[model samples]
Target: MDLIEELMQEITLNNFDVGSSTWVDVTYINNPHSFYVRPTSYRSFLKSMQAHGQKLEQQDLQLSMNIVYYSKTLKNFCRGLIYHVDTAKKNCTCDIYAIDYGCVEKSVSLKNMYSPLLEQGLPPLATHCQLANCEPKNGLWKDKEIDAMKCYIGTEKAKLIVKGKTCLKLIVELFNSCPDDIATMLALTGYSTLGYNENVFSRIPNFKQEKHYYTYPKIEPGNVLHVRTQSGKDLDNFYVAKVDEYYDYINNVNNLLAYSKQAQSLRPEDMKENKAISVFVPQFLRYERGIIQKITVSEEKALVQLVD
Candidate 1:
C-alpha cells in the first residue's frame, strides 16, 4: 500500500469508535449540519478526505493531517486534534475539539491552502461615473459634461484652474459688473482679446460695443431679448431677459446646455482632428443670479455661455 493508504489504515484501526456517543453524534447529527466528519467508517472517511482534498486544490493551497492519542476521564479532556496550514508563508494552526473520552483521534492533512482565491473578489477601482461608457441620468449637474470639460482642460490645465490662474472667473466677474456692451466690458475688464483677432471674445460678437444702426432699448427685467449674431443664422446671441420666478431653473438649464455643448463639441476627438476646442465654464457662476449674461466661445466660434 502507498504511504497515504498505510497512514489511513493505521488511523482507522487505532481511533475507530463505532459505539461511542461522540462518534454517533459526529456521524449522524453534526456531519449532516456542519463540516464535521466521523472517519470511523472507511468509506465515509475516504469520501470526506477526497472532498477535503478537492476543496484545497480549488483554493490553490496545500495541507496535511495526522492522528493524536491521549488517555481521558479527568483533566477536562485536554487531548485535541491539530490541523497545520500555511498562508502567505506564515504558519496557521487550527485545533479541533475532542468530543469523546477516547485514547486515539483522527484528522486530515492539507497542503498549500489558499482560500482567498476561492472567495469573492474585490469591487472595481473606478466608479460607474468614471467609466467611459457609463451615463448618469438626471442629477443636479451633468456628470458627463463636467467630466468632458475636465478632460479637455487636460491634466495640466486642470492644475492651473485649481490654482485659480484661469481667466474664466475674471470674465464672469466682468460680465456681471453692470449693463454694458461686450466690447466695452471686455476693454474695461482689460481683455483686449474681446475686440482683437486673437482675443477669446471674437467668437461671440452679438454683444459688440459698436453702436447698431437699429434702435435698441436698455436691457431690463421681464424683457425677453434674443441676442443673435450678425448673420442671425447662428444662435450665438445673448438673450437679455428677466425670469424672476423660474430664474434658477432657467439658469440650470442654460448652464447644462452650455456645458453639454462644450463637452460634445470640444471633445478630444474634435481637438485632435483640428476641430473646435472645448472651453471651461466657471463653476462659481454656474448657479449665480445676475444682470448681464455672458457667453464665451472657442476660436472656432462654438458658443459657451453662463446660464443665468
Candidate 2:
C-alpha cells in the first residue's frame, strides 16, 4: 500500500485522540459506555458511498485487493476493512469492519467482496466512543438502560465533548440541550452513577448550572395548574394527564382486535392445510410463494415450504 493508504489504515485501526468539542451524529449505542459517532467533518463519506454504490450497480469494481473491500452483507454493499481471512478454506469467508457504519460483520463470503480504490483516502466514518465519568448502576448495562439511552438520543445529532482516549474508544461526554450531559443524565435517571474520572468530574456542570437549564416542574401536591374556565372564574384548577396511558391502552386493544381478526380470517375454507400464500423470507430479505404444510392455531405459527 502507498503512504496515503497506510496512513488511512493506521488512523482507522487506532482511536484518534479528539480533545475538543464537535457535533456528531450518534450512529450506534450499545449502552452508555459504548457508542459510535460520525462527525460532521466525515459527511463527505456519504457522497463517496453514493458514488461507490453507483459504480457497484455498473459492475465496475474488482473482487479483492489490499486491506479494503466493497463487501455485500445482509445489510447491503458497503466499504469494509478486512479484519480476518481464512485462506485455508476452499470457499473463504472474512470478518470485516463496516467502515461507514462502525460495526463488525462476520463470516462474509469471499464472493461478496470487491476491490476498493485507494484514492478515496477516507478513514473509518464512525468513531468509537464511550461516555466518560459514568458507570452502570449494577456494574452492567441492562436492556432497560440501553433502551433509555436510545430513547434519549433517538435519531438526533449531539454535541460531543471528547475528553480523553482509550485503546479502542474515545472517552467523551455527549448531550443535546438537556438539564445535564448524558453521563450525568444517566446517573440522574438511576441507570448509572458518576464515576471517578477526574477529566470529566471537574468539567461536570454544577447544581446552579443544572438548575439554570430548563426542566419541567415536578408534579406534586399543592402545585397550581391553570385551566380554561367557562366564565374565566377559576384560577387554580388541576388535571392529571393520562394521555400517554390512554393511548397505550387504545393501541393494545387495537392490536389485540387485529390479531383476533387475522386469526379468525384463517379459517379452514380460507386457508386449508396445503394453502398457497406469499411468504416473506427474512433470511433472504425477499418475498416468495410458499405452501403452508402445517399450522398451529394456538401458537399462531405456520410451517411454510417454498414452491421453488
TM-score of each: 0.14, 0.49
lDDT of 2 by residue, 135-201 (tens): 8777689999899888878777799987765334667888886778888887788888887753333
lDDT of 2 at 290: 59
lDDT per residue for candidate 1 within 94-210, as digits (tens), equals 322232221122222233221221111111010000111112233222444444333332222100001011112111111112344223333344322222233223334356463
Q: Which stretches of model 1 miss by more than 4 angstroms?
A: 1-239, 244-265, 268-279, 283-308
Off-target runs (Cα >4 Å) in candidate 2 are 1-19, 49-76, 86-91, 177-179, 197-308
Kindly give the stretch of ten consecutive residues in candidate 1 with the minimal lDDT sum: 122-131
The 10-residue segment with the lowest total lDDT in model 2: 250-259
Model 2: lDDT equals 0.57
